[model samples]
Target: MNRKCDKKCLELSFPAVEAEASKGIATLSARLTQNGLPEHKTDDVKIALAEAINNVVEHAYSGIASANVQVNCRLCKERLEIVISDSGAPLPGLRIPDGKPAQLGSSIQNLPEGGFGWFLIHQLTSEIRYERYDGNNHLCLRFDL
Candidate 1:
């Protein structure tokens, strides 16, 4: 875990693996609060960020050597912008997912085990963007503070 922090910006770069993702998310949440992200909005930001990073770990680098996840957060007067980038697989079709909520079935046995990631991310973030260029994928999530 390596980070550079200042009054308005927090930058984090780490390996795109499960353990690192967990620690990175926790560390990011702490730094965000210290950098003045409102308490009420912290959970939203953290959830969205974790989803984004998990995608990079699970889907992006599924069969390839794990790469690094680069996170840059900028806090302005009324908004927080987070850019998470990695050298893993690009999003399918190089586009953002539709983020439809996973269907809840009639019984516990029929319930989905996953698929809520993008939906919750879209719900929590004010804006989301994805770009694939130069063999890298960049996902940006924004929150209105």
Candidate 2:
């Protein structure tokens, strides 16, 4: 189960990392559209957010079933702040690129295997940050509407 905040910002906290990756994306997408973001931009933001959370599930948790994922979303005047956290070992030396998908690597995995979420997120979002604290890995994505 997920908890929703009552403020302008909707915060959803989930226990399973994989479930959080999917449900969080849907909830945030709805909130973005409800908050007056255009349809095309909202779709893009949803895609990027899905990728970020998927990374936490696949890479951070390494398919472990006992991990927990926390998704906190805040809607401000200028942008939306999405925070995805997991109780797992921190990822070391993982860096997000700073450009479009074209500038990223041209590997078949991104196209045929569908592992391009992180790369697309790097290209689509305005800002992204990775943090590790007390054995928790957090990925924060900022999207401009």
Candidate 3:
């Protein structure tokens, strides 16, 4: 973490997926506030962070009790970047498709309720990136100030 950048990082473990996601979002919002981010961008940052965290919790764990989701947040000048990583399962190597209504309840949709997460993420964030490496799934989102 860069001191000049006001970068802050947090690591939390939660048994409930929703709880984990919500907690991660709350933490991000608080960090932004403490770092003097404008009020207008707070909601956008919160939503994007929640989506990234929920995707890992719901899709990777799939109702399992034992799962770990790691959230990393870095604030640089006019940008905030959040990187969420999980080790539960390998993700498909395809970008999230565009221009289609997200279907929530299918084998393709693990939680049956997280389809809207990605949609909201796209609407709120400036950039979204995904990567899978050595059995770890990583999703990174950035919000420009």
List lDDT for all candidates, in order.
Answer: 0.89, 0.69, 0.68
Best by TM-score: 1
TM-score of each: 0.93, 0.74, 0.74
Give candidate 3 regions above 4 Å deviation. 1-16, 63-65, 102-114
Question: What does candidate 2 score on TM?
Answer: 0.74
Kindly report which residue stretches of model 2 are placed more than 4 angstroms away from their true locations once superposed.
1-7, 17-20, 94-115
lDDT of 3 by residue, 10-129 (tens): 455454367656776776678668877778888888777766676666667775554677777777768877777787655554455352446655566465543576678888888877
**TM-score computed on alpha carbons, candidate 3:** 0.74
Each candidate's number of clashing pairs is 0, 0, 0
Name the candidate that leads on lDDT: 1
Which of candidates 1 and 2 is the stronger one according to lDDT?
Answer: 1
Candidate 1 residue 67 Cα shift, in angstroms, is: 1.0
Model 1 CA deviation exceeding 4 Å by range: 1-7
lDDT, residue 76, candidate 2:
64
Between candidates 1 and 3, the one scoring higher on TM-score is: 1
Error of 3 at 94 (Å): 4.4
